[model samples]
Target: MITTRVVKILYVLALIPISLFSLLMAVYGLAWIDDSAAFGYLLLLASPFVWLFQVFATRIVLEFVINQFKISEYLRAIKDKG
Candidate 1:
């Protein structure tokens, strides 16, 4: 369990570069179609928003998993008490 937690943290950290690349690709695609330098510039400027979205998504997922784990633990404890 400890190792799994460590690996998950590392995996999430490793996604930083992947998110940056995705943001760049998105900006490039927008530039290709819209041909608006401003759009590309704005997308680049909002790169942090993309990262923030990823972080929020990751946090939500982890929170859900943790809540599930805690619920299961509580149920087991209740069963044991009974």
Candidate 2:
């Protein structure tokens, strides 16, 4: 079984890419501001929402994975008892 410290590290690591992606979107949107203000503003405004949604989704997935591991561990304990 993996240690809790490792799982915490992995969870934090997973968030890094998501944060980078959101930053890129904001940068791209800023770059486009001069050419198309509306589109640029749209992207800028949407970036945060997108980040929030992605984070929420990622959290759900991680929780599911953690739950699965816990379930398996519990099952193993049960089997051993029997």
TM-score of each: 0.64, 0.86
Report the C-alpha lDDT of model 2 over 1-82, residue by residue, as the tens digit. Answer: 6745666787799889989999999999999999999999999999999999998887788778888889999999999999
- TM-score of model 1 relative to the true fold? 0.64
Cα deviation at 80, candidate 2, in Å, is 1.6
lDDT against the true structure, per candidate, is 0.71, 0.89
Q: Tens digits of per-residue lDDT for model 1 on 1-82?
A: 4544854786578587758776786767577556777767667666677777777777677767767777888899999999
Task: Name the top TM-score candidate.
Answer: 2
Candidate 1 whole-model C-alpha lDDT, 0 to 1? 0.71
Clashes of 2: 0
